[model samples]
Target: MCGIVGAIAQRNIVPVLVEGLKRLEYRGYDSAGIAVLDTEIKRVRRVGRVAEMEAAANEINLTGRLGIGHTRWATHGGVTEPNAHPHVSGDLIAVVHNGIIENHDEKRQALQAKGYQFESQTDTEVIAHLIHSYYVQDRNLFSAVQKAVTELVGAYAIAVIAKDQPDVLACARMGCPLLIGLGDGEHFVASDVSAILSATRRVIFLEEGDVAELRRDQILILDKDRQKAERKIHVSDVSLASLELGPYSHFMQKEIHEQPKALSDTIEPLLEAGFVPELFGANAKELLSKVDGVLILACGTSYYAGSVARYWLESIASVPCQVEIASEYRYRDAVANPNWLVVTLSQSGETLDTMEALKYAKSLGHDKTLSICNVRESAIPRSSEMVFYTRAGAEIGVASTKAFTTQLLALFALTATLAKIKGRLSDTQEQSYLDALRHLPGSVQHALNLEPQIKIWADRFAPKEHALFLGRGVHYPIALEGALKLKEISYIHAEAYPAGELKHGPLALVDDNMPVVVIAPNDVLLEKVKSNMQEVRARGGELFVFADLDSHFSESEGVHVIRTPRHAGVLSPVVHAVPVQILAYHAALQRGTDVDKPRNLAKSVTVE
Candidate 1:
C-alpha cells in the first residue's frame, strides 16, 4: 500500500510531512516525494526511501504552509522518479493518491481528447489533471476535488492542494482508509493513523465517499450525500513507541520479540473474565447460536492463520470451517449460506482485497460477519457485524511477526467460545484451555529463548536457495506460514507440502541442496511426520525440524532439530509460529535484505 500525508498549518509543514513519511516507511515504498505550495509549487520527488526525499527537501530548502507527501508502492507504473507521488498538473494542483483508479485509462483517454497531455504513467497523475480541469473552471480547489472524485471509479484515498488556495487542503476517500488529524493551528490528513500519530492524538475517521476540507484550525467534512457531517474525533491510544525500534536493530526483530506480551494482551482479559458471547459484541451470543458454519476470507499471513483455525474449529467447536484467499474469493461465485458466519482476518484491517471480499459476501446475503484484526478502529472491523480485536499493537514489519501469532490466539479464543456456546466443551475442558492460555505468555517467552539457536540455523539457511517445509494434520498450516516467512523476508524460494504428499510428487525435487524443514510438534501425527522426514533424509536432503520439547528428535549430521518451549497442545500452532518468525528474521539479517520492509511488498495491501 502507498502512504499519503498532508497538512494545512500556520507554519511550514514540510517537516511534519517528512516526519509522517518516515513513520510510514515500514509500510514499504519504492519511491518518495513531496509537493509544497510556496511562491509556486515547489516539488522534490525521489525514487527511493523517505530519507532520500528528506535529504532532497533539506538541500533545496523546500518549505510551505500547506503541502502533501507520499511514499508510493508502485501501482500504475514502475518505481521511477517520474512515477513518484505528489504528481502535479501544470503547477496548479499537486496530488498524492493511494489506490488504483479502475477507470484510469478511460479517464486518461477522455482527458487526452480534451487536449490535456500526461507526463508519467500513473493513475495518480490523471487525478491531478482532472482536478486541474475542474479548478480552472471554478477556481475552487475543494469543490474541484469533489467534482473530480465523483467522475472517477475505483478505491482511492487522495489529498490535493491547489496553487491558488494556500490555506486549505482537500481530501476524499472511497473504499479505502483515510482520516483527518486534528491539531492546534494545524490540520492533517493521512492514509494510516500511524503516519500522523506523532503530530496529533485526536483524529476523525472519514466514512466512505466522505470529503474533507482542512483549514489551519478547522476541519469540515461532507458526508456521502454531499451534506455537512460531524464525525467523532477519538483520542488515539497508539503509543509513539510503536514506531520506535527500541533495543532492536530492526522493526521485524522488535516485533518478533514482542509476541509474548502481545499474546498476553490478546488472551488475558477473555481468559480472566471468562469467555462469554458478549466478548465479541452485544448480539454475539445470538449470532453464535444461529451460526451453522464458518467461512474465513483472508490473505497472506492472515490466510494461513485462518487455515490453522480451520483445524481447531472442526475439532473443538465441531463446526465446518472453510478458508479462502480473499483476492480470489471476491471474483468467484460459491454457495453462500446466510447462517454461515463470514469471518475476515487482517492486521491493518484495511487490506483492500479482504475488505472487498467482505462486501462481496454481504452482497450474497452473508451479513453475519466477524473481524479478527489487530487494529482498533479500521475499515473491515468497523464494517463487520462483530469484532474481536487482537491487541498485537502496531505491526510495522512487512513480514508479520506479532500479528500472526496474536491472530492465532484470537482464533483459539473464538474456537473455545463457540465450543462452550454449543455445549461441545465441558466445564473441565474450559478450565484446562484457560490454564494453558494463562501460561502461554511464558511459553512464548521460552520460544523467544530459541532465538540464539535459530540464528545459528539461519546461518545454515542463508547460503541456500531452495527450501521445502513439511507438516501434517494441524501443523500443516504452520509449515506453510514458516515457508512464507522464509521467502518473504529472506528472498529464498520456498514451498510447503503436507508430509503425506511428499511421496506423491514433492520427493522428486528433494536433494542435498534443498533444505527440508518440518513442523513436528508432539501431537498425534508426530510419528507420521517423522516417517516423512526419513523420506527426505533418504534422498540426501538436509532436514530442519521444529520439534516440541518431548518430541525426542535429536540434532544429527543431516537431521537438525530445534525444540520449542514444550508444547501448548491445541495451542501448539501458536507456539510453533514464533521460531519460524525468529528464523526468518535472522535469515534475512544474514542475507542482508530489508527485514521490516521487504522488496515488492508493503505492510498493508490497500490496493488490488
Candidate 2:
C-alpha cells in the first residue's frame, strides 16, 4: 500500500500535507514525494524515507495552497527517485496513487501511440498522462478524471491536482480506501483517517466508484453516473494521545502492552452472549448449520492468526480448515466448494491482496464470505456477507501485536460457536473453553508483567545480529510470528522453524553466538519442545524460553526463562505471544531502529 495526502485551504497547505504524510508513513515508506502548486510550481521527491523527502523539500520552495503527497511501497517499478509517486505530467497534472492499474500495458501502449511520452516505468504514471490526455480533450479537470478513471480497470485511490485548478482537488477510489476530512476554510483527502487526525476529526469515507471534488471549504461526492450523492460525516474518537507512544519508547512497545485490553474488548461481547452471535448476526445458527469447511485468507500477522485458527477449528468445531496467504491464494486455480466458508482477516480492512482474494472467491459463486477487521466501514467488511469487528483501536505500528491477538480471539470465538451449533463440543467442554477464554484477560495482564524482564533479556541479546525461534503444533505459527516481528522492526536476521525441523537443516545454523527463542509453553508438545531446546543448548546456543509458570521447567546456565500464566493448550499461544512481541520491540529500541516505521514494509499491502 501507498500513503496519499492532499489538502486545499485558504492558507498554505504544504505543511499540512507533510505532517499528514509523516503520520501515514506507517502505510508505506520505500520512497516519499510531495507536489505543491504554489505561485508557479514545485515538486520534491526522494528515494528513501520521509526524512529524506523533508530534507529535499527544504532545498526547494514548496509553498502552495493545493498539494498532494505520497509515501510509496513500490510495485510496478523498482524503488528509485524516478519511480516514486506524485507522478507529474508535462501539463502540471500531478497525482498521488495508492493502488494498481491492471490494464496499464494496453493503456500505456495507446498513450504512447498518441505521442504521450512517459518518464517512470510505473503503472501510476499512465494515470498522469491519461488525465492530461482527457483534460486536453474535454478542457475540464473533474470530467477528465472521471473519463480517465472510467477507462482504467483496476483498484485505485487517486488524488489529482492541476496547476490550472490550484484551488480544487479531484479524488476517486475503486476497491481501495479514501477519506475526505472537513475543516474550517480547508479540505483534506487521504488514504486513511490517520493522515488528517491532527488537522480534523470529521471525515467522510469515500465509497468505491465515488468521485469527490474537494475545494477550500467544501467536498462534493458524485457517483459513477455523475449524480450528486450524500455522504455522512463520521467523527473519529481517536485522540492524538492514543497515537503517541507516551511513556513507551516506541509504538511497537505501546501496542504490545495494549494486547490485554485489545483481547478483552474483542472477547467480552462473545463471552457475555456465550456465543459468537455478532459475527454472523441474523443467520448465526443458520450459517453454521450449513457450513462444511472453512478457508482463511490473510497476510502477515493475520496469516499466523489464521494458522492458529485452523487448529482451533479442527479441535473445537471439528471443521477442516485451510489457511492461505491472500496474494497467492487469489492467483491459483483453486476450487471453492459451495459449502465452504471463506474468512478473511486484516487489521486495516483495506489489505489489497486479502480483499482481492475475497472478491475472487465471491466471483466464483461463493456467497458465504466473512471478514474480521478493525475498521468499521472499510472495503473488506463492506464486501463480505458478515463482518467481525476487532476493537484493537488504531494499531499504528507496522508490525502488528494487538491486532494479531484480537484476530485469534475472534476466530476462536467463531470456532466455539460453530461447535455449539454442530453439536460437536459437549456442554462441559464448551464451558471449559469458555472459562479459559473468560480468564484470558487476566492471563494476558500477567504476561504483560514480564515486559521489564523481557527488556532486560533484550538488552543482553541485542548485540547479536541473528536469532532463531522454535515451537511445535499451534506454537509453530506463534514462533513464526515472533521471528517475523524480530526481523521486521529489529533488522535482525531471524528464522522460525518447527521444532521437529530443527535437525533437518536449521541445526547447521545454530552456534554459541546464535540466540534461540523457544515457545515452550506446557502442552502435549512440551516435552518435544524441551527436547529441541536441549538440542540447541547442547550446541552452545543461548536459549530464551517462554514457559508456563507451573510447568516442570527449571533455569539452566545458558537458558533464560520468562514465565507465563498457566492456561490450556488451546490458549497458550495467545498468552505466550506477548513476550516475543515485547522482546522484538525492546531489541529494536536497543538497536536504534525505527520501530514504528520499518524499512521496505507498509502497514497495509494494498498493491500486490
Best model number under lDDT = 1
The candidate maximizing TM-score is 1
Q: lDDT scores for all predictions?
A: 0.91, 0.88
Q: Which ranges in model 1 have alpha carbons more than 4 Å from their true place?
A: none
Candidate 1 per-residue lDDT, tens place, 238-324, comes to 999878999999988899889889998998778866777888898999998988899999999999999999999999999999999
> Which stretches of candidate 2 lie above 4 Å from their native place?
47-62, 77-80, 216-218, 224-228, 426-431
TM-score of 2: 0.93
| Candidate 2 CA-lDDT value | 0.88
Q: All candidates' TM-scores?
A: 0.99, 0.93
Residue lDDT tens for model 2, 1-608 = 78999998888787788888888888888899999887545789998788889888877756888889999998888999999989988756999998899999999999999998989989999999999998877567888899899988988999999878877799999978999999999999999888899889999988879998998877789987789999888998777877877898778778888887888888777777787555566765566678899999999899999999999899778899999999998999988887988999999999989988998998887888889999878889888888888889988889999999999888988888888878887879878887888889899999999878999999976899999999999899999999999999999999999999999999999999999999988788888888888899888988998889878888889998888888555888899888899899889989988888887787887777
